[model samples]
Target: AAGVIQSPRHLIKEKRETATLKCYPIPRHDTVYWYQQGPGQDPQFLISFYEKMQSDKGSIPDRFSAQQFSDYHSELNMSSLELGDSALYFCASSVGGGGETQYFGPGTRLLVL
Candidate 1:
């Protein structure tokens, strides 16, 4: 049983820098989502892609962007790093359409100094 995989389990950055996080969804899963969780805060949906197309957008900042690939993996691009941006970035995957049950990855912990 495979699950979503995210690279660079942890990251460190300075304010004003940029970082790119990678995600590999479960096989056959067509939907990939990105979420950001600040300390003691609930996970916030950032963006999602279905079948390689942008499907939904949430509180993602203008300085951030994401995309799903042909293989169903996804990437989150973050820029203008700020201390407030430090958090756990999670990647979740689901099969079929939106509303389907999703499974999340371990998450990438980003720290801005």
Candidate 2:
């Protein structure tokens, strides 16, 4: 089984800038998971997209948004990024419409300057 793939493995942004992080889930996986890990912090669940619809959300800031495309790939759109937004953004994929034994992609290390 192939692992998840994330683009632009590293990112740097200025305060109030916008960034888009993309995720390519494993083929045939219907569930996508998004997580954020700040410096020295445990990964926090951000959101989930199932069947191209937003299925769940957790602690996602107002300035952050996400979506899943028809192709099953997902993207996180962040606007007005704050310094606190500097974190590693990870995405995972599972077989069904929820988290369970997911395969994680190497995160996008975002640094909000």
Candidate 3:
């Protein structure tokens, strides 16, 4: 399976501006996850959506929002992006079941100025 896909491989946003990223999960997968990877730091989980509901928030701000549609595609919207928001955003997907493995996308690199 292709697993997942994300758009805008890279982006640059001004301080306090808004940005949107997209993600597409493979068919038959019901869970979609998002993560943020900072320079020289481990990837931190942002949120997870299963059955159209948010499952968890690992380490994300209220300004960072996400949605999963009926088609299983998801989008992450960052409002008032700051310089500290500059990082790599990754999308992943897994079956909502035991031992499910999350397969990640290429990631969107955002450089907030």
Candidate closest to the true structure, highest TM-score: 1
- Candidate 2 vs 3: which has more TM-score: 2
lDDT of each: 0.94, 0.94, 0.89
Q: State the weakest 10-residue window (summed lDDT) of model 3.
A: 93-102
lDDT tens per residue, model 1, 13-89: 99999999999998899999999999999999999999999999999999998888899899999999889999999
Supply every candidate's count of residue pairs whose N, Cα or C atoms clash at under 3 angstroms: 0, 0, 0
Q: Give TM-scores for every candidate, taking all chains together and pairing residue i with residue i.
A: 0.97, 0.97, 0.94
What value does the lDDT take at residue 1 in candidate 2? 59
Please give the distance, in angstroms, between residue 107's alpha carbon in candidate 3 and its true position after superposition.
Answer: 0.2
Q: Which stretches of candidate 3 lie over 4 Å from their true place?
A: 97-99
**Candidate 3 residues 9-97, lDDT tens each?**
99998999999999998788888999999999999999989877888778889998999898888999999988999999999988883
- Tens digits of lDDT, candidate 2, 5-113: 9988999999999999999999999889999999999999999999999999999998989999999999999999999999999999998885578899999999999
Which pairs clash (backbone N, Cα, C closer than 3 Å) in model 3? none
**Residue 59, model 1, lDDT:** 98
